[model samples]
Target: MSDFFIDIIDDDGADQGQEAEVVSGSSSTWKIAIIDDEESIHQVTRLALSSMVILGRPIEFLSAYSAKEGFELLSSDDEIAVVLLDVVMENPEAGLQLARRIRQELGNHNTQIILRTGQPGYAPEEVVITEYEINDYKTKSELTRTKLFSTIYTSLRTYQHLVAMEQSKLGLQKIIDSSASLFQERSIREFSEGALLQINALFNIHSEGIFCISSGPLAGDRDMIVAPLEAEQHRIVAATDIFKSYFGKAIDDIDDITTKQTLHRTLASKEHQFTNKYICLFLNTPSQWEGAIFIKGDIDEERLDYELLSVFAMNVSLGLENTKFFTQLTQMAYYDMLTQFYTRHGVIDRCLNTAVKNGEIFSVCILDIDYFHEVTESLGFEYGNKVLVSFANRIQSILPADSVFARLHSDVFAVVVFDDKPLDMEFIAKQCAEAIHVDGDKLRFGVSVGVSQFLPEDNLSGEELLRQAEIALKLAKEVRRGGGQAFTPSLATESRGRIQLLGELREALASHELVMYLQPKVSLIEEGTVVGFEALVRWPHKEKGMIPPNDFVPVAERSGLYYELDMYVVEACCKILSEHSELTRIAFNLSANSLNRPELVDDLENLLARYGVTHDAIVMEITENSMAKGGIVIDTLERLQSKGWLIHLDDFGTGYSSLSYLLDMPLNAIKIDRSFLLQLHDSDNAAVLLKGIISICKDLDKKVIVEGVETDSQKAFAMDAGADVAQGYLFYKPMKLEEAVDLMKKQS
Candidate 1:
């Protein structure tokens, strides 16, 4: 050890490289503090070891003339790695006391202390060194320049190793905790943040830094994670408190352009790049999102950063990729594939979950694209798809931030808005109408809107709220030009009543609670002579004495029960015709809904054949407006005409009457509506209008029936107008189907 120290302190100033290496062990500098009473002791110590180097660093000295001064000097500076103390200072125990103060009062366990004594009997090397926690003990006679260097070198090296071990313990612990969080965490932003936290702990860096992800997906990446952003740009994913404003900002916007350029190069090269002052590592995960981990700090970590930080980057990158995978999976499950809106099931499922607050209220609105099927059929589904997307975007732009939207069906969209303030559904409906019309107006289309609100008090599911809106939407579609309507109490009441009626009607059909009434239409020339009877359905309920046709028929039409009712009437009329061969024909009514049936011809033909009745024994009556809405009404009517099933334009002079009905529609007769006949006594114009209508029918070689003639004067007026048939109470009243059958039997 003595020869080694002697060689380290070469007096010739030889081996400068060896001197530099032998001083501090590194190119870095280590500070040493010297404490003694004699000025010569401090000078000699400086001269011997000032040029010494350890760990590639040279030694720097700080001196104190007294024990108290030494304590004060060491107190101000903590980086002093080693303290060389003389035992005989201002007092015999001065160096020992200073050592005790450094260990106890200053609480610095890291700085090495070397104790030396000039007197042997005053203090034993074992006693003072053991008692005061001194690092080493030597006498002035033995501490030559070589021995001094050996002592200083050994002490400094031990101090460096101890510090490295302590730092490694703290840094490794922090890293273990951080890695646990990385594996357990799910957010890319949070994972990136933890990366910076662990990096700061490991490298002793406290400056602000940004973690940026600003390149295309990495190799072997099948998912286009960042393709949705404009031109696949890069973004700052996470940052420290001081740099938090940089989050979500583009990499080009970073104030540190040099750092930004370096990150770009690192991403381009797919490798790490280090500068004299900055540390940046490129993270390549097998996903489309590339990242750059950067730090501009007080300490340079480049020496061991690749070895140490590479672990952190690998763990963090895997965590980030997993997070992105989960995020995309969730988006695909909950969002509409075409418009990026919420799916109906997705919104409903979310609402049914525990995420909603206990007392939260939401207003739900539904928008329907008017004649959407027509648009899709005429313009093609591709154009219709564009219209749907455009309409959705417009609605999203019009609604508030917290609103949730979804495409519920092919042409229907559902929206849910939080009710933070007093909900004004009318205003929401208006906004919805406006949004729909922007595209609708250009395309010559229209839309209807209906709105309802969530009322937990009502105990309605999200689906029920949607149903309420649909009921209101049905009413809106009937309105002119198809406008907006909010779900009011009246709509709910009407819907409830209709639903109840539908249920009762279904029950009545099963139980045979419904019966038929026949009103006879007699010729004016043949007094009190019954000819043909019109079939009128009557529902006699146990609860509500009688259900009128006006009330129940409309409900049946709206509820799609009209088809059943029409079939029931046809069967009843066939039974009557099968009983009495003398009956001329029974005319049955056809509503717009029933007239649109695709299987109407098949049904009627089967019924006639089953009952052994000719098609000539039945006359089908329809109002003028009913035919306008059914696309196949004209074709079906022509088919019926060909089969000798007489088609009559019933209530023709009142509803949707057109000259086209006389010229184009196949018709055996026109029945002037009851209104014209009722006004005959008071309004001369009504009488003149009736005469002209009858005249037109005569000119067209069509039969004219004057219906609802309740008085002798109405009958006389009908005869004067050249009517071929008169259906009025003045001739024959309404009778039961059995009574009509008996009368027909009697006539036969």
Candidate 2:
């Protein structure tokens, strides 16, 4: 092996292209401390070490006759990577004490120490090496020039490895912490801001920049940049301008888009050797969130940073892509992409299709925009589409719990109202008509609604019932602007008899024929836990055993009783809960009517307060149908959260349930529709679907309630699938409120 001085020479050589200062000729400089009473010993030590060349550099030996003088030299200069000590100096064993002080008091872990003792007995090799933490100990006579170089070489190399390890550990920790913090931030802006701060601290450079780009029409368009004052202006300019310009065009391309190479090359600049950029392109479609491009300045302190930068960029890109994917998946499944309303398909699957065994009365209402086609032509298709979405949003806000609202057709929307009292469908329709007005202040156009009471006759099919309401809607339009018509047999007696019935159904809810029923949700786990009960509305015709909600719920909502129906449901639920305080709690299904009311949340709060029920115990089940339609639903749900109601996204995996709901709403639990569970046995993808739902709910920190588990296998599957709660025939069907209370007492 080369002499110890040779290794330092190799490292400090100008050829290394590092910050290495030259102290002498080709000979390497060594900081040697000579401590001896004899001046000759100092001279002799210097002469011997001077001739010794480690690598291409000759050693420059330091000399001191006393330990005190040697300490002074050591204290003044820390560049002495290695120190040589003498055992006998101004005081015996003085060298040994100094070595201990260097290791303990000075806390210098990088410097290497070697002790040379004239009198070896003063400090034994074993004792000094173990107790004093000195790297090496040698008798003066035995330390030849060759042996001395060997010992120094060993100590310096060990120190180098230790320093490298410490730096590696620190770097890894910084990366982990930054990644974790990014995941915790709620918005992209917040994540970017946090990352900027962390990267600045980690690199110890004032210059930091973040430029993000979103692709496509639906995606957000923005640009932001931030940097420290001390950071070079030219560096920022090159990084920001060059990097952004390069990625901007590349990311703009709709076909064959990628973040690799094309964008990464632009990040190369004077301040940094190489940089990494990533592009995540979202699929072209109607969605809340879309494509994203992230570019980061790369500072390569280590020679291996090229690969690390690539890995970092890849990770960031993947995260952004995953978020966008989740968001789009939710929208397609839960909402009406065109008008941002609950699609007809989603509402029926989640809300209207509930397992209603006993005869129950629900109300149905259908409303059509008056002269919508003319409005579309006059306003331009794009503006018309916007107005339609906006109009749907307004009407959606007023829907009540137990009511499912949806855009049934291009110009028609349907709502199923759940209420105990007779709903004034005319008033509900008029309120919706006003909601559709443009600019909130202008009466842009009128809306006409057809109403129907859910009679057993309506149970034939959801389509037939909706058709009946549409018939009523025609009568409403015939009357005048903003006129609401309820469905009646005589109304149907006209050419568009369904339209006639819609005109009369509005009169029926006012007479109070509609009644309310409560369906109990029992919890198998957590003994005595009823969990909650669902509020169901029923209509008892003087002749029919019970009218099905499917038949009439839509009529009331479309005819304008949606808001009143919501109040009725809330009032009845409160009464039931008040009557059965010992039961776990009660939940009510809500329609767009109640949700749209500016006073809805406030009213619910007051009712809960009056009933002495805490918000925690009261859950409002909102169908994926209503959630699909955006606007007031988002704001209303947020307001309801502020008021303390536990809002649940009912029929979770069945609607346009875009990822926004997971992040935006404070949903306590999600109920898996019974259909999804039933399909589990029929389709090969049953387990996969169920597992996906469970995983999403678990990740969002919400509970999952499986709606149907009739068979033993279904129950076992639900349990194994990690369902938090189960409700079906296997447990118990929707029974009378009194029977539910009796069962709860027995279970308790």
Candidate 3:
């Protein structure tokens, strides 16, 4: 055993006398060499140490008649820990030269050297001890058995301490290096296992054991223990017993579980005979662990385990805590908030990896809700959210176990089927649409599915697959009714055109690529006189011939690019109306999404207030179809009216023309649908319906305007039906702001 190990065992042992004897015995086994020209001195030193033994090993003596013999003995056996030499051996400086040569020439730093002499008068104690590489000096007469034994023991103890310190330094360095790589571990099991190994090694403890506390899923698993061989079977048995005692019990009993506090104390009080074979060098109180390391040797006799374990416990706690936090955070980042499914980014990452490995044949399907925005506008955002959530749940319920779903955006979702089966993919898509039923009100959504198969060694990533599926979805949407459209490479060419249009759309609002056209609302009393103008939004694409608002409006809303467009439109209206003070008040229409914004009223008020425009001058025309069913739509419209802005109910007869809203709404004007006028000559019902609408308006004290009049007969009919104003292509088609002003001047 090393001298350092002996000292630790000695100091740490509770039985002081027994521990001292053990330490002495253990130290005595280290060989001690004596070099002098005297045989009597060696015999005397051996007698001094004869009674001492370090553990079971006894100290043996080697006597040398000259320095040459001492050097030869030390050279042959490297285990010699100490050398006692005389300064005046064969010559006065011979022993001094040997000491220097042993350290410098032979590189033998392990051996401890003690200089002794018959005459100390020649070499003083301070000079011989310092100038030469020797431990101590003693006179021949002072070399009694007790002193000699004391000197040797003290020297060995000092040497042992230095070796131990060096080992501890290296261990600390390894711990620092190991701790840095903790995050790189693949699994919690692997991380815990590696940490235990590093911690035990750091303490220079070959006998320690570690185990984790089992909780929740691991409740009954008692065999889950991590430990080294030195911990022995007793620790394992004790741990199993400890676990079973509290396995199903509440955690409140954890405080009073120590054997030392209860079992050992009781045994001692009763004077009962007990053996300590199972006791270990873990004298310090054991910390509670779902798991723990049990030491089996005399813990009070060895403080190394206790002190080292304290440090290990701190490191392990920090590592485990970090692992848990990172693992949870990683999961949350990859999942969708509403569906608890993989997000577009997460699904794409998984697909790309699968494609790279070329293992399973993966197929991707893109599904879009048919006219979903119409429902959102009609039923309200709250109901729309419910429908979306229900859609996700239904897909999860019916999809194959191997398939995965992701919400790509508002109305578009993607599902990746593992098996390359087109029939299965189509069935799942249809099931998702059909399952969204709410009693009498089954959801009215149609799904367009796009199918594409995974290719081996495909440079195409998830992003490319999404693009291909989107192309197929576009083809499906073009069909009007619900159906599946398989992806073809030729579709990518048409997709490129749409992508290019999208890029231009991004700059459309910013660059004023979108132009407002004013359509004249001419008076029925006189053909040339204009009553009002309807503001229309038109996007003129540089590459594609004029892209209709219907084609791009939904796209803008889906991409969250509608807010910018809405803000720009509101701001532009403020500027345009601020210049047009001559014509009757112009009305600009807003989408349901814009009206639902809590900040819409504030934003609109601020813009008008900035330009010094009165609420009466600018009319906010919201379609009845859009605002009829949304929760906050009525409240928002009332709030705007309360702020003194005129609200016009546009597209009056198209959808959900609630009589209650027509009677109760705080609207300034209502535009009659032109369908009644087109069939005025053909049907008497059209005339009767128009008269009923006119009578309702007259009763409500609201002004009436009629749209889509293309001839003199329709305009005259509107004027004859108690309509206050009339507008259509016969008056003027939508024209540019400047052109509308010119036409107004001409009419005036």
Candidate 4:
């Protein structure tokens, strides 16, 4: 074993003890290896270079005696910057062979090699330097202290440059990889966070920093760069390292005064600022937004290439612009502008991503605002918008923080709850029921809600959940408005049945399976003489037999099929009038939806002309609710009345039975609903209400037809009440065309 000792040689050739600096404690150090068989060579070299510091780092020496040991030592520490090898150690060509192994076997092209030899005759310096990848070659006798120091200095400098170049290459590659990822981010905050991490990796620094932005047009204006700003204008969008907790805070809220000042200067100047202790990079976006990243730590100027940083900054700016654009497009697609709630598409996406995809249980509730059109029609649409906004705010206030609320249609909104517990639908209903104050007026409206649950066991998609909820909503509106219902299997079955029946009804209309049945309207003052007949629609299915009107009428009304059905009824009545002249003034009911059609009068005129039926022979019966609609319905009635058709208000006491409707509508007669008659025998209020309705119709000079008179008492009450006509089972059941024609002949 070779013992190591540090002996400094003087000019007199006496050895002197020299103490080496304590460089082992330094965080930054340059590692060098001395591979030689002679212990004296190691001692002298260590004595000479022990006090040397290059590039602000102390030198760390590693010793290996034999060529094999040197190879092992170099293989273990690739960071060894410089290697000094002695020729003729263990063998004449051992140093040469080890050099080849270091470069070829270990693939270490970085460590600088210096060769020293005592036998210049054995190995020529030029040949050895060229073939062995040696940086410097010297004879031992020629290597004075001055030459040794100069050679070591040059080799260390060369090694430093090579390492820096390699680091630069890696950093640039990192920037390229990071730019690709940053460009893919569609969120500004996410992109900023990723950019901060990449910046840290690019410079190989562990520093605290924040990414901040000032938004709006003024932020991007070059002229406004130096203007005084509000403290809250600069928002910290992302943070890294110790500044992670500072995210979303304003720049002024940062505790570090120096960091805040530097960031403010960088943003105000719209330029990059680099100091000995920190770095601030200003980023410009295509939008009216400016941003800055403040890194609080010393950066090596050698690694901080201005050109590379410019390229990186340009990429970050493009990424920010792309993120902003995509974010805006996303908001427009997923959020409603007026209410700032999620749109229908947004709600479905949330359900899929946050619940259904994860197999989590959730529930969906849909709300339809009843009588919404009246608000828009009575007030202006702008005022109606305020009401909708108020209603949305109320709903949002009552929902859980995690719930997703959205506007699905003009008057329909939806809520998606993530919890597995049953939704408190009554609470939602009560919240929505509160009156909305719009423009100093308390506008009251009813909200009908339908709810459905999503269970992993059910295996339903988000759209299917919404469909089920809508089915329940339709039932709520039909069974009773201003209430809520949860989805049941029976509702789905009924919906499917209605859908099937609607298809069949369309086919029936085309095939003429639907026919008009008439019941005689007898005059009470004329000793029960038949004056006219009320036409009713009846469907006789080829296989299922006669289907009652009640079974399909509501279905048609809900499905928007009532218009076609009403037109069919009108044409049938025209056809009957043309065929039998004795059957005159046949009255058929028109639905509220049918009355709102702009072409109703024109279509009726065409049908009458086609059948050669006069206008006086046909009567149009609309419900009291149709009169209450008051806009298109009233206009349509007036147009028909002006064209000489008799208009009768049917089901008067059934819906919206306001006396104002009797005065406002242009009606030739009013038919009391059978519901009033059913109560009249048992309740005195029913009799008094019926009497009052008939007296009002008489005072208005409008004829009164009493419907559903089944027994003698009902018939006597109709005559005593001075009703102009009575139509019931007692007079004649709704009969076929032949029976009706025979009855008309008998009455004549």
Candidate 5:
């Protein structure tokens, strides 16, 4: 051991019989405990710290004779900010034990401990400093006054930093708690209000703010709205104390034009703006829903999350997005895509909520554009869309805001008007129909309205109420009524019978109970030789007798069951071809719905393979309307032709019979519609049209088939027009497979 120096230190760490210099700074003292067995070490520590000050605070040293005494002092009083200790004290490892006790047992991690050793080799300073949690390691002789004061100042600085961090952590926790509470609010108003409050709490600063939304879809072509309406549409969803009265109000409605322009500009740029007057953070809500927070204060947000308002702004954005999405989803659940009016489902929802539950009198008027199909046929779909939009705008504009208007079906609008007293449904229907009849350009097309009233004592569901309205609509259209017809019990009975017929029809097709009848197509050039057969589906009902093709085909097509019916006919044709080798080729008709189905190709492949039939044995007769379905349908025809199937453009004289489809499609034949053959009796225009069609087909190297040849004159007319084949009742009416087989065998 080095020769020990002795100098006594009192309890207050004052040197005995030695005057110590004092610092003049009047600040709180940093209590530093000196733990050592040697009195000389404590005396030297006190002398070094005697005139020293850190952060304007004077240093105070507490003297301990041994490690045990230092532990007792630190345990009783937590004010000791630093410990200057000797490792080899009363016990060789006593200082080490006390350092561990002060840090671990006393849990005084905030205080700094320095380990001093008289004999440098007694214990390794590095090991003692690390294991015992000592802040600094120094031998007694090396601890000069300047070095000791520097160490104490450095340690004091570290302790002050820890306390400041603790304060910040508590403050951050408060903000987290506030932000977490915001999610529970459902509406945008409540959510933004909560978020604004949290932002204020985050900074502990008072500020005014508002949330605005620019309306549009989150993810769609934003151009759906007219450009003029884009900037004109925005609303304040929430606001601070200053703008509270304007919550849920449109931005345009506010008198503050400057603020409105600022908001619009901010929404347009999608950027945050910060200045002394205010800081604006754009909350990027999905779709065109533009929202932001405007804080009116000079805030130094360095203590908070560096971008303090951004967090609450983001929360408000997400929350408002969720609420708006849900709101739009609710609207869409009951509204039409094109008109922004309620659909049939929407009307039903309204009825369930109000009309059905209350005793108030309400009438539903079902209106339709008269001769709408002709409108679409004469003009293209673009013009038709314009017509629909115009009609919806006119009707909606004329009706009271309280009235529920919905697009119940294509070209049909259902309006439910509410009245306290009993409604004269007929007068109401007439007035509504006249409104539509004079409604803009739609007046040229005219309109028919059907009125239905809720009958007392009959608890009707929304579906039943709408069904009654539909009955009236059909009645008015059929009768060509001046305005509309009111619903009657007889119409409901008729509708029920139709429904029953539809159900039976579906069952008959599913069970293959319906029979396939063939109408012979004879070669006009050969005079009597049978060339091919047209397959026609016949529904022979047990009770109702033979149901006319005119009856169920329209109903089936209207109800979206035409594809199934067409597919069934194709399957029957394939089966007939497979069953009879004499039947060389079968021509069958397919509607627009069947043609557009993407699965048609796959389904055809599977059906042909299942029946072991070749594609060449089948002829697909598509209507003129199907040709207008654009390139996809034409492509399908080409693909079918490539696979050896013959494509015939049936009803070729009707609809948009563009020379384009005739040239573009892989057509094998053009079947003249019955209208052209019938029209010949009225004028030579029919003869001229038929001859032109045949000449076109001839030039294209395609076959021509004339239908509706009922008399010898008509057949002669067709042959003269260069028709290769003719099929009509005058040759042979539609016959079942057995009859057709016998007729074919006789002819053969």
Candidate 6:
């Protein structure tokens, strides 16, 4: 055998004079444990492996004299790579039991075990190796210096492979987790910093780096032109370690020429460049900005997984693209594209945030350009856009620096001023009144303003405050085109009441709460005989008592409910004519909106047919304005007159009375308004005007019905002026169907 083993065998008793020395642990050494009942074996094994090294790491020898001592030593030191176990200690199966316990109890599966026994017959090699989880089985005589070196070297190499695989698994897991965290960043700079940090962690290196971006075309550009890297065009968005101070500076400002050149080359080639000294990872996004990450560190080129790095780079690119898309969406949402002002939603958010910060009173002003539609209709929309932009600029110049200005909608802008005083609306109007130069044309426009205050005690939300301003704006437009109005609590109250009444009115129509009342028209020449009756609609509210026509008629018109109301009146009149033949005819008024309906004639005829009433029994009365509406109203009137229905112009002298309507319209009669009769007692000019109107109607072959003749002097004057009909309280007031029937019975 080798001299090393001859010495170990011959000098068996020599170790009795000395103890085996214990070696301290080290990161660059593989731990080995020697366990046996004989101190000579421990000394011999330690001497044989003292100068040996495996996988570039020296051995750390831990000596134990018995199985119990070996178990204690191995349990305390988990880094032990290989154990030389002795079979016969205090008991025959002591080494066998300790081997099983090391694999099971201590759970040190990675530590390789080699069983050696001086009495091989006591523990058979096959049984001990199979039953005990031992890596190798050998007799003490067979374990010479050569075999011992080969066995320990092979076991230590195996342990090295296992540790490397475990570290690779953990590093890959960390990469996946870091990728997820990088995607959560919303800004380019934030994402870059996270990427740099994650890469450093992946390699376990504390390196310096800079993330630089160049302004140019994006990933999917057709031309694929990359802008020249000027000092202003290239920006270092993120930096780490020694390069942290270089963040937001130009890439050219980097003192290292190698780093700057590598970044430029990587971006130009659109590919990653890996080297022993540094790594340049190319990055491209959908935002048309190309970039690169320059990391200054030595990475193992042969060991680096390029495929895994590419996957991480793809995730970085996607994260950058997502951030760019989100930024673009935010810009579109918060700013007006044309005027570069805050949009309505952006302004409201600003107002809410400001209110929370200041907790002080402020005013919101809404300015609407008057006749803006006319401007768009006369000029092209392009020109109109220029006017709008110029107008916004003018208003913005006059406002305070801290004020929030927004474009609410077309031709409407809003302003939120952080002050107790309201905006000087008159001065704003005057400023906008100046002519705007658009395409070499001077265009003058007026603005109407509405203001609403936000009081902390009122506890109004931003949306509610804006709503109140809009309400005042509507009133300003109605009160005067170029004036301003402040919001009042009564206005909102009145608006709410109107809305409630409208809802109730709709229900009233549906449930038959509206009743038809008739006021008799008498013929003075026939000694106060009841000639015909005028149909009037009255609402007997369940809560508010009787609602007059003046109260609800305008509401119906404004709400587009006048058509249904008019048809209801017509149907009621037709029913009356069908019920009592003595009531020869009934006259009911039609609003201008109702008269303009295409189905008005058909609806009226259908109602008459349903009630079995003759066409001549229904008289369609419209105001002068309704007749003067000219196209559909006049055509509908002529159609009804042709069908044997008389069309009377009611409230004749009240609105826009045109002589053309009196002469050219299909009118069978004219009812003079009540104002003329009321004016007769005040002036003789009223008498002359009334008589002249009656004379003109007579000459035009039309009958005259004098309405609202309440006094004796009015009745006498109507008869003397040759009026065909006189409707007044002097004859009969408006009453229900039962009362009208009783009055007609007395007349009969």
- Output the lDDT of residue 500, model 3: 67
Which is better, 1 or 4, measured by TM-score? 4
Span of ten consecutive residues with least summed lDDT in model 4: 1-10
Cα RMSD, each candidate: 12.5, 27.5, 12.8, 10.1, 17.9, 12.6
lDDT tens readout by residue for model 6, 53-144: 55445778989988889889988898899999898898988899899889889987778899889976765557667766788888888877
RMSD of 6: 12.6
For lDDT, the strongest prediction is 4
- Model 2: per-residue lDDT, tens digit, 1-748? 1122222534333233332222112233545555566777667666555554443234556666666776677777665667777777777777877777777776666667777777756555576688777787788887765565566556655554444344445544544443454222123333333433433333222242433323331121112223222211111111233344432233233132433333333333201223332222111113322222333333223322344444544554454454435434434554566865556765555455551223357767877888789766777777677777777777667667556777877878888886645567667666776634454535456777787666544454555556567677877776644777777777656645334545545555677666666566655466225677777787676654676777667766656767777777777778777778766677788886667678887788888888877777668989877876668878888778877778888887778857677776778888888888788788869788788778888888888888877888887787777778877777666766788788778766
> Which ranges in model 1 have alpha carbons more than 4 Å from their true place?
1-229, 237-243, 256-259, 272-289, 292-365, 388-408, 413-441, 453-468, 479-481, 507-513, 542-545, 579-584, 728-734, 746-748
- Top model by TM-score, which number? 4
What are the per-residue Cα lDDT tens digits for candidate 5 across 1-748?
1101112223233323223232212236779888888788778778666865455457788888887788889988877888888888777888888888887888878788888888876655576577667788888887776566667767776665554444345544543443443322123445555666655544444467776666443112111222323544766656787877666565666666656666766777888766554667787865546776666654433333435456657766776677665555645666677887777876786553467877657777788887778767887776777778778877777666778788987889888877544445445445545533322453455577777787546688778888888888887877755467778888898788778878888998889877788999999899999998999888888888998888888778867788889889899999999999889899998988787888888888788899988978888898889888876787787777777878888988688878776678888898988888888899988788778889988898989998988999999988887889999989999988998898888888
Global lDDT of model 1: 0.74
Ranking by TM-score: 4, 6, 1, 3, 5, 2
TM values, all candidates: 0.63, 0.37, 0.53, 0.70, 0.48, 0.63
The Cα local distance difference test for each model comes to 0.74, 0.60, 0.65, 0.79, 0.72, 0.77
- Output the worst ten-in-a-row residue range by lDDT, candidate 3: 229-238
TM-score for candidate 3, please give it: 0.53
Query: How many steric clashes does model 3 contain?
Result: 23
lDDT of 3 by residue, 494-596 (tens): 6776566667888887688897888877666665677677777889777677887788876676556776777777777777878777655677878777777
Candidate 1, residues 38-146: lDDT per residue as tens digits? 7898898888777656555677888897899999998899889988888777877788888989999999888999887787555555766776678887777788876
Better of 3 and 6 by lDDT: 6
lDDT of 2: 0.60
**For model 1, where is the 10-residue window of minimal lDDT?**
217-226
- For candidate 1, give the lDDT of residue 392: 87
